[model samples]
Target: MTAHYFIGIKVEKSIRTKLTEWQNVLAKSMNYKDWTSEEDFHITLKFLGGCSDKTIDVYKNKLMNEEWPGAFRIAIGPAGYFGNPKQPRVFYADAEKPKELEVIKLEVEKIGSELGFQTEGRTYRPHVTLAKKNAEGMSPLALESYDLLLDESYSMLIDHFSIFRIHPQQNPKYEAIAHISLNKEE
Candidate 1:
């Protein structure tokens, strides 16, 4: 079987629990084909469709040796959707764009391209996916704007990213194959 991979920021357990609760509430307002499992919540950096183990090894080694921007805090923004609001294709919590995040993303793109990985055509929009697609013949929602789930200002600390392999038959479909820490202190 082919190994499908992506680079992403892992969501902490506490944040996952919180997001899952918020997703539960959102479910009452709108319906979706798939609600993201808490374990699967993440902000994708790049989606690398398929690769050979040898290629994956080379990519992983390069990442380990590459310089990354130091850890920074990324705020969780309000709820947002792609496609129509009432009948959305995807629903997610946005992550504030920090230059540090951009640096890492761009670096990943550069390195990936060097390794013959296809570059993403769309501009990167960091987010933790909540749900996707309208459920089978689901009714359209009013789609009132939803605010950040956390009270006051909230942000997640970023110190690392990883290459995760997809396991479609699993609860947590994405499994981290390699973790690349970003200026992690001892």
Candidate 2:
């Protein structure tokens, strides 16, 4: 068993399917060491890194017990990358930084800090990673050619969040440790 984990909102199936299709198209133009598995797509809120089972349990309890805002809608789209576009380190689908999403991230951050995890220093830019680790020798992504790909946006509903265990060797590497819905009692 592994201790690596993160807290995130799982991407809905329809969105996953769309992303998978995009991945297929992108693979022809980009080389990445790891293309995120469709089943593993998520909007990460916090990466807790390695933690003991005891810590996970404590973290889980705190999360399940905390109150979250009820389901809200967020816009996701316009394929983008972190770092330089041609040599991008991360390819992603970004979410507009709506207040509803930011509130939950702050709450999760507080929970993580209370458990002795170091606070994340970066600004919260909500995104679902599509791929990581750019491999050598791929054509630069031309903006005009992929207008259909970049011009569109999708609305995603956020009703719940989960703690996921990372299994690097597994095909669909993320496994849910716990799920807490904002609209209902856990």
How badly does each model clash, as a count of residue pairs? 0, 0
Give, for candidate 1, the lowest lDDT window spanning 10 residues: 136-145
Candidate 2 — what's its lDDT? 0.85
TM-scores of the candidates are: 0.90, 0.92
What digit string (tens of lDDT, one per residue) describes model 2 on residues 125-168?
89889988988544236544663765457899888999999988
Q: Which residue pairs collide, candidate 2?
A: none
RMSD to the hidden true structure, all candidates: 2.6, 2.2
Clashing pairs in 1: none
| TM-score: model 1 vs. ground truth | 0.90
RMSD of 1: 2.6
lDDT of 1 by residue, 1-186 (tens): 888999999988877877787777677677787889899999999999888889889989999999888888888656666877666788777788889999999999999999999899998899888889767432223334443352322478999999999998889899999999998654
